[model samples]
Target: MNLTLKIWRQENARAKGRFETYKVENISPDCSFLEMLDILNEQLVDKLSHPVCFDNDCREGICGMCGLYINGRPHGPDDGVTTCQLHMRRFKDGDTIVIEPWRARPFPIIRDLVVDRTAFDKIIQEGGYVSVTTGGVPDGNAIPIPKKNADEAMDAAACIGCGACVAACKNASAMLFVSAKVSQLALLPQGKPEAARRVQAMVAKMDELGFGNCTNTYACEAECPKQIKRSNIARMNREFMCAKVCSEE
Candidate 1:
């Protein structure tokens, strides 16, 4: 299939950027979206031109390193899939695909299709983890966790921090991402000790990083590759309120 790709190009974070169009021909339908980009970059290199810079570490969807706004949707038009997992077959022949990086205040454009996602790392550093040292693997049967809580924790843990949630929100909110991080720990016993502090710190850092607030639009959950739910936001709110109340006591 032949395709026209209108991709955003920026030299660096402070550089002005715009869409630049290029044509690709004879692309295999089975080719992954990144692979199609790779082909386009190869052609550019053949012409002694700079290649399109996009993010991708693991070609598989596990690592959230790959993210792109294709045709106005985060990670392309697919549901529950990342950009690297998106196949060229999803687009028709002779289609014009518009690709851009995650557009948000915290995620400034670094170059073509690559944004600095270190904001996410900063938020995580502010307390997205349980630091308790469990020296070795404990017996699985030692602590009996409620099945419901365990299931919910696992679901929340699915969040890969791709920033798609922030990209999808009209307000560019990080609540869905922050909430998922909070819930994964709040629901687990190992995370209980630091639950209150974790939620408070993560939410505070999310705000400080210039991410917008959640207004119940549900865009984040809809575009999340992992299908992280907005319900996590509700749980986070409760955790925050309870923490505040307890701290006041």
Candidate 2:
């Protein structure tokens, strides 16, 4: 198949950016979106041109490094999919694809299609941890947590932090991502001790990182590759309120 691509190009963080047109032919329908970009970069490199830069690791879709805005949607047209896992068959021949990076103040473009997502790392550093003392590996049934909460915690923990949530949001909010981090722990007994301080610290860290406020439009849920539930945000809000009340006391 043949495709016309309008991709955003930026030299560096401070450099002005614009869309450049290129044509790709002989694409395999089975190739993933990032693989397609890889092909484009190889072609440009052969011509001694600056190859497009994008972030990706563990193309299996667990790393969350492969973030891209494809045709105005994060991760293309597929539901609950990341760019690295989006198959090219989703597009037909002669399709014109517009590829860009995550557009958010917190995610500054380092070069073409690559953004600095250390803001997420900083938020995680703030308090996304279990304070329980570690010895050797404990028995599987050492502590019996209800299956329901365990599954909910695992679901929340599945978030890969790709920043699609921010890219899809009109306000560029990180609430969905932040909430997933908060809820994953708040649901576990191992997190009970730091629950209050953890929520407070993570939320404060989120605000400090220049992330936009949540407007509750649910756009984040729509774009999240992991299908992280919007209920995580609601749970986070409740945790935040409770944490604030206790912190004030």
> In candidate 2, which residue pairs get closer than 3 Å at backbone N, Cα or C atoms, i.e. clash?
none
Task: Please list all clashing residue pairs in model 1, or write none if there are none.
Answer: none
Q: Candidate 2, 14: how far from true, in Å?
A: 0.5
- Candidate 1 lDDT, tens digit per residue, 1-249? 999999999999999998999999999999999999999999999999999999999989988999999898999999999999999989999999999899999998888788998999999998898897888899987988999999999999999999999999999999999899899999988898888888888888999999998899998988999999889999999999999989542
Q: Counting only residues 3 or more apart in sequence or on different chains, how many pairs clash (N, Cα, C under 3 Å) in candidate 1?
A: 0
TM-score of 2: 0.97
Instruction: State how far residue 194 of model 2 sits from its true place (Å).
Output: 0.4
lDDT tens readout by residue for model 2, 1-249: 899999999999999999999999999999999899899989999999999999999998998999899999999999998898899999999999999999999999999999999999999998899866778998997989999999999999999999999999999889999999999999998887788898989999998888899988999999999999999999999999998887652
State residue 109's C-alpha deviation in candidate 2, in Å.
0.7
Candidate 1 TM-score to native: 0.98
